[model samples]
Target: MLIKTIFAGFGGQGVLSMGYVLAYAAMVEGLQVTYLPSYGAEVRGGTANCTVAISNEEIASPIASAPDNVVVMNNPSLEKFQHQILTGGVMFINTNLVESRPVRGDIVLYEIPCNDLAHDLGSDQSANMVMLGGFIEKTGLVKMESVRSAIGDVFKEKKKAKEMNLKALDVGFDYMRNNGGKA
Candidate 1:
């Protein structure tokens, strides 16, 4: 099995972190994974995105010409990557920040209010985790336990951050599960 996903948003929205955590989780599951991140020179507030490819077999390339999944956290990202999703693929949108919707009908779409959910969880920084959780729940590409473990590994030095992120993840997962998985 193979899945290529692109996470895109403003640099401070944790777009790279989302892809990193997913790649780490895939690694923990013993899957072959590749994560490639790109961002504007301005860093925060600038455009940032990452491509993650997870596969059971050897991957030939790190680049995703047509990603199987696209998680867009902002309107600009949605506009940029919406057309890049493979037909029948999935698109996860952060409804709180992105008001525009994709025009494509071939790909499945999930609208998640990530920032709102994270704010409710007490930390707006955890918005990415919320989106990640919903994506995981909808796709089931990797085990939840693996993601939790990866999160722990990524934030090993910050106990409070780890706890809050984990909670945000759970909230996203539950939100997707309860919302019937598609928009």
Candidate 2:
């Protein structure tokens, strides 16, 4: 039941926050979890990524060399981590922003219109949540209920963001359920 996942995007796209939320949700489920984040020198638009490992057993490290699942929010991230996904892994792409597809055929690919969906929900910044929703639906790594509960704890200070983020997450999950994954 070990799952190594990576979330990648620009710094302002909430990449790290998604990882944090995932780690927190895993904790709530009583799973062993580790989260590590890295960002480029430039803050807002710089490259940002986070690796999270969740398992029923002890986690040896936070680094994920070959992640079982990768969520890419932008084209650069798609290019950066596309080849790093393990065989039989799943890659969730924010199709609204990433125009390209993965070159590898062994891994599963799930295309999500994250930015557009978030905009439909009235907040483009919630794109990360949309991706998270799709990832959860596709992998069942964490229950949406756990994520919902974790959201309150994660964004307790930002009341408005909490509501929008929850909605965006629902949108992503529903989209994935309604539309099957593309390998």
Clashing pairs in model 1? none
Query: What are the per-model numbers of colliding residue pairs?
Result: 0, 0
* Candidate 1 lDDT score relative to the true structure: 0.95
lDDT, model 1, position 172: 98
lDDT of 1 by residue, 44-160 (tens): 899999999999999989999899999999999999998889999999999999999999989999989999999999898999999999999999989999999999999999999
Worst lDDT run of 10 residues, candidate 2, spans: 174-183
Per-residue CA lDDT of model 2 for 1-183, tens digit only, reads 789999999989999999999999999999999999999999799999999999999988889999999999899999999889999999988888889998898988899888889998999899999989888999999899999999989999999999999999999899999987564
Give the RMSD in angstroms, all C-alphas superposed, for model 1: 0.7
**Largest lDDT belongs to which candidate?**
1
- For each candidate in turn, the TM-score is 0.98, 0.97
Q: Which stretches of candidate 1 lie over 4 Å from their true place?
A: none
> What is the Å distance of residue 176 in model 2 from its true position?
0.5
